[model samples]
Target: MQSSVEAIFAPQPAPEGYAEHIGTGLTLRRSASRANAQQVHQLRPHVVEMAAQYDRLTMPVEIIHGDADTIVPMHIHAEELIKDIPNGALTRLPGMGHMPQHTAPQAVVDAIDRAAARAGLR
Candidate 1:
């Protein structure tokens, strides 16, 4: 029996398979999907309500912001999120654009290690 699916609609191969287990470096250009602003607009209310509920107002958190980020605008979201978080420390990385995981993998790893240590995740 012939399937109804067309050849063009077949699933594409995953470039990096689970067996590879590549290092935690990011590939945002290939990974990130640019969504329409309108799509995000519809979810704003739900997002804000969720944020208010899980603000982490009493937890010790470290926030690192890329000053040159255009996707997640430092002046808008990250800064405000940091402000709302109690005992939050913000690290502003100058000349670092969006997607620090790709541009500064070491820094991201270091931050995670530090956070883990602080949280006693040894």
Candidate 2:
């Protein structure tokens, strides 16, 4: 069973037999380099502090989130974001997971259109 954190961040399963293809020397080196890249954990506090001031934003904010997203739960991220921002709106897509931009591009575009329209930018 996946831990709650893993479930939330990596809800989708890797493609079958993907591990078997990672043995190439180039792949291993690339993977290792990426793993060693800069860590952003130290910035969590700063990010949270900035997010807390959402209501101060004057521009329209649109949150496009999948209802089935597990990595960042809709309630904890999208819903709360909408509630916190003065001009925020949420476009909740049912049966979609976290990567809505990849999984449902048209919906994401529609959400963008809606946001633009709401902001009178269309």
lDDT of each: 0.60, 0.71
Q: Which predicted model would earn the best lDDT?
A: 2
lDDT, candidate 1, equals 0.60
Clashing pairs in 1: none
- State residue 25's C-alpha deviation in candidate 1, in Å: 22
Candidate 2 colliding pairs, count: 3
TM-score of each: 0.60, 0.68
Candidate 1 per-residue C-alpha lDDT over 1-122 given as tens digits, one digit per residue, 9 for 90 to 100? 01111111112222333223443233224443244445666788887886886456655577777787655678897788876776667778777766566556787877777777767884
Per-candidate Cα RMSD to the true structure, in Å, reads 11.3, 5.4
User: lDDT, candidate 1, residue 121?
Assistant: 83
